[model samples]
Target: MRVIEVEHFEAWRAAARELLRDGVPAGDVDFCSPSTQKSLFGDESDDGGRALAAREAAARQRRGGVTVPPDFLKRARMVACHRDEHRWNLLYRVLWRLTTAEPNLLHVAFDDDVRRFDLMAKSVGRDAHKAQAFVRFRRIETEDGEQFVAWHRPDHRILRLVGPFFSRRFKSMRWTILTPDESASWDGAALTYGPGAPASAAPSADDLDEMWRSYYRSIFNPARIKLAMMRREMPVRYWAALPETQIIPEILAEAPARVAAMLKYGASGTRAVSAAEFLPEARDLESLARAAAGCRGCELCERATQTVFGRGPSTARLVLVGEQPGDQEDRHGEPFIGPAGEVLNHALVTAGLARDEVYLTNAVKHFHWEPRGKQRLHKKPPSRAISACRPWLEAEMTAVAPRVLVCLGVTAAQAVLGRDTRALKTRGVPFASEWCERTIITWHPAASLRARTDEERRRIARELAEHLRVAACA
Candidate 1:
């Protein structure tokens, strides 16, 4: 057994090459006696590579003739926690050293970063750049004319672990795994691996690269997107294989513009369907509500228990909009049938408008609520949700074509007015929005029911009746 220590990588490489060529498996070589470059090869012409090559030759000459003793395996673990290129090299050097023998006495000292790296590396294998650089394979032509090749890289090299994965996933195609240190290719049948070629040109796959570039461009989600996180998730080394790497600079440069575009996009409702095509001047509220129940325009249908359709007179001139269905409304499968509806009914009677004469509905045609105890409590919908639900309200408005709309609460006010309505500040004010004409903000009857004081209830109820009167005459 003998050990040869040399500085030049080619020295070790030449030795391994000769042993492999001579049918000597690396494991069979005994390293009981180690040879340093200064001693075994003498001056060695000061070329470390030449010294290693000579030692390998000498070892082969004595292999069957000399009694070789196994070298004791010495083990040491990487202790540094911080991530640095130098630190990475140190870790790999130790790792590769241990691969030559079964490890013994491998000591590990802890660092937070080292611990994190260990955890991450355990499941995913080593950093692809290090550990597996020397992998090479030979190209073989199959009897059926299919070309394929296979080779073994360093045991724990990142490419070796991931290369097979890429091969299996990207099966049915030929690909090259080019590391700076070495390269391997599996055409279809046999695998070829060897020392890395000169860094002349990056191995190219024009078709796949272009497809990857296009996909990256297409799937750049503007909503809730983060650039730094993306870069962290996909490091730069991977970009050499991916087509979109070249376009990343442009994408980052235009990020501000993209963000501005998203903000400008805001919560505008979907493009309006032409009233001329759908309305035809004669569609009734029932047809419209039934049509709205089948809407797939947004995800509101998936979250809400049921679509709470509008219920009221077909020819009513006055329209009322509530925020959404309450618990009772949700259970009953009707709009405005909850305690809020009872309060609204009393206000309607005081205002001299019969419940049967005016059409009542919700801004959102669904009960958006979350479960609490046994009750499904109402949850405020996001701006996007509100925007999504606006179409149904518009459809109802378009069909019923009410002369005046009464926005019963903040959500209703937002849906109709396209802005927040402070109910206390603007309860009696009338304004027009993109969806409706002669729209008035009013205290929702539910507000009256929730009031703690009789005086507060009286104030809200009086305001609600006043708005009803305004709708009746308008």
Candidate 2:
């Protein structure tokens, strides 16, 4: 058997292609990689590799190249990252079958080769996910600038696949992630890789360690402690290099006493969850938007198509808060872009405010609607939903910190003010509020759309514009 040595997916591709060109049978070749370094048999001579390349070159001149499905190439890359000794052999078998015998071999799920490689690929995928979740970066002080270092041991060679994930997330900050197999560094503009490193290469602690542990302690719910389930999801093998895991044992130990104290002090047996709990520790607007996309704060999120998050400049001096997303806004995943939005856009122009200059958001991010035949009719959000989603609005308000906050209608007013707040009664007037320097209540453009008469609609629309004028100049 000819010994074929490859260290990565590209090397495997090159060797496999040459072997296939030379009509070498899959079972006749010894597939080897760094993961399979200690072989039962000795290594082959350099002449063997040279002879195989020459044979492949001669065969290429005699016949055209073979073809396989795009799906095979995609799966082969993931399988190559797996540490299975037989991974290379299984991949070649699948490729050979796809090119020589059954082109649709992958579609046959029960085929032993197909199922085996699929399982290997899935394991690699899970390893990549764990690498993303468990890799905790620690701050490292350098004379140059801010830097962070994290160490993790993934079950597979997944640095290539997960490097972009980290770079996209912490792009603004300079950081390095070290693993037993490889290392990656991001300098804000580009990502580069180097040799592997030991766990000791990563820093043990940073200034933020205690602060992070305190935050974790504060958020830990004794009533919701599920040690087995948590361990299963975040396996113990990944506990090292994760500073938060250092405190997990103590937290778990204190669970019973904490639960007992909570019950004795009139605390509910179940913890009260809100959007606040769903918010990411990061305070950036983009991070907040990504976290909101998966929000399960209330039942409304279940029915809504998606979370229609706020949009605009972060430095805006004015903030416009509405009720909830409309049907169009829900489908599009933006704050305002539907018919009612058009009216509001016109009113903004008439009031000397640019749509992109001020922050546009809502009390409820989801669209609360009921099916009416083929169309979905907008429904007013219940008080509970408004309460459940207020945390998101509060987060946005805090992030924006607007000089003036304009409540589009009663729902927005109640969300910012109190549940009993009346919009029409308090329209066109600004009041001191904790969230903003001045809070103004106004009739929503949607209210004007639902008016009984054209004259009355025009009256409300003009009144709405007048209130917006006051907000713009405030």
Candidate 3:
């Protein structure tokens, strides 16, 4: 066997290329580390000299360079970072197959060699990502200046891959990240790499470590705790380096009592008087809208982009009231301009009424939503939030004083005519309200937009148009 030993990935690649160029079959070669035991069958005393001579000869006889897929190089680089001693041999075997048996060997998804390389690459990539996320720098006072340092342990040789991330993130500060396999230091102007250091060299605690622990404790919502998911994202092995992990047990121990308290009081248990102070004294629509912008009547206002008040003429003959502002309405600072708004517009045209002739507003002025990944999904406002915002809606009604009051959904119906109106049962029937000459109830345009089938959507749209047509003629 032609015994070839290499120290690193680049050296292995150089030696493999020479062997491939000389048409040496993989079975005839013994790929190994430089310090590994020699092959028992044959011992070549001048193996290193013969290998160098072969490489020089192959370089002279190079007609054209060997070629592989572009993605293969990237995959090879990631796999090369793995600490496995057999990686060189595995990669060389794959390279041989790519050149001879199958030109598109990497494309074979189930191929044993391809799967093994993929797993190694994936492991290295995951380790790099976790290292970037979990590394916590602690401030240390030194005679030179205050410097930040962190100690981390990664599963792969990924210091070179993840070093640039820290450099870019802390470009203005001096910091050092030391791992068992490698170490990196940044001095604000330049980054330098050095040999690996022991974990004992890192600081065990910092002055602000307690503050960080407190912040973590404050943000840890016991009600939303998912131990399995937490462990999956932040493995227990990394707990030693993370300062927050020290208090995790304490938090977990108290979680049951905290959760009981939360359940008893509800999420928004704080009771404050209605935000009457934020209301405008002016009886005009524009002034009311401006004042509503600053109102903090309920917790909903804290999260919504802005308060969306009523819009249209102060003397409109018809006034329409719906639930609350949706995601798009919150962003645009206007009511009724989302998918539900589109449905309303189409229904208005079909009912022979122009949208501009009617005043459009929501019973609650602020949007209430919860985040789902990148989206802000609408959540129904609680009864207290609706009650808190009632004064603003009542103010708009009193200012506009439309001939016909159209309640577009259950919340609006309950807000105007009291909860006993039973919006679903009273829809399409005209009634008299003390606030208006005629009051009509109908399904909110959002209800039609959420229909599970096309037929159901059309039916709901027709029902909405009929109710609007009656209110317009009233």
Candidate 4:
């Protein structure tokens, strides 16, 4: 047996090439680190001399170079970063097979050696990603200036892979990230490496940490808590170094009571008046629309350009409720005048119904959006926002008293029907609502506009027209 000691990936590749050139089979070679001992089987008399001669000849030869698939080299490099001591041997064995036996060995999914290498590489990659996401930097005072320091514990040697990500994100700051196996430091202009460090070398707490924990606690939405998903995304193993984790237990303990309180009172718990409180007790449709213009029942009214109320004949038999107004609709103070409205008008004409024959409004009257550069991008309103605006929608339903109420999307369907009703599952099905005799669920015109392909858009438009035809018949 021939024992080859290699310290790193490049060293292993050089040694493996020499051994392969010398015609030394994998079974006769014992690849290991410099500190490991040789196998009990011992080396042959001429093996060392032959390997030395082959190494010298390879250093002199400049003809054909070692060739392997690009993916194999990538996997080999990632596997080399693993903590497994046998990783070198495994990679060299696979390299030998790729060069001599099977050129396509790495492509075989069921191959034991390929599967092992893939698992090791995947583990190392995952460790790298986790390290990038979970590292928290703390401010520290030093002789030169203030420097940020962070300490992390990763399962693999991934300091090199995750270092660039931190450098790109915090390029203006001087920081050092220390792990048990390695350390990386960025000095504002460049990144430098150092030896490993202990957890005590990092600061335990700082003044900013308390503020960070407070922000974390404030943003924890009790209504949308999903314990399984939270644990899956941010595992408990990484909670030790995160300052926000100090309050996770407290947040979780109070979540149930907070959600109950939100349900008992309003979502914000400050608004006690019903939708009727926002209105001026006017029974006429125009008076109700004017009253809705000054509504502060929800936070959306604060950001919207103006309140978009329903338009069309109040004597119409069909009332259509949409999710909310769009950017153009919010500016123009009308629903169904934007691109989505164009699609709805076309579908209504195709379904043999005139636009003036139906009253049009929305479940939520205001436009909800987040600013993107100079434009306002539409944002989906949360359930609380919908609930706050439901009173206005209920008033519209009471005033119109249409023979057929058509809900255009999930938000509108949930507003008219119960919250548990799903629009996709209830489409084309007529259901009874408290405000109307018959209510039909259908795809919103915006859904057809968002379709991925022409074929999909045509299909959605056809389905929407069919539902509208049913509503027209009613």
Stretches > 4 Å off in candidate 3: 34-65, 260-474
lDDT per residue (tens digit) for residues 1-474 in model 4: 988776557667767777777777778888777585343222436685467557656754832566899889887888887989899889988988998879999988799998999999999987876786688899999999999999999988788777876886687789999998778999988987777789999999998798668656644667777789678657898898999998988999999998797667665667633455677667667887767776767767657766888987778899999999999888656798788998999999988998877899998888999999978988987777788778777777778889999999888888778788887877988878787778899999999989999999999999999999998887
Q: lDDT, candidate 1, residue 199?
A: 34
Worst 10 residues of 4 by lDDT: 36-45
Each candidate's number of clashing pairs is 23, 0, 0, 0
TM-score of every candidate relative to the true structure: 0.40, 0.57, 0.51, 0.51
Can you write out model 3's per-residue Cα lDDT over 58-163, one digit (the tens) per residue?
Answer: 6657835678887877888777778897888888888889888798888888999999999998999888878876898889999999999999988887876778
Model 3 lDDT-worst window of ten: 36-45
Point to the candidate with the largest TM-score: 2
Q: Model 3, 350: alpha-carbon shift in Å?
A: 49
Which runs in model 1 stand beyond 4 Å of their true positions?
1-283, 420-424, 432-437
What lDDT is obtained when candidate 4 is compared to the true structure? 0.82
lDDT of each: 0.57, 0.82, 0.82, 0.82
User: Candidate 3's error at 133, in angstroms?
Assistant: 1.9
User: Candidate 2 regions off by >4 Å?
Assistant: 34-66, 256-383, 390-474
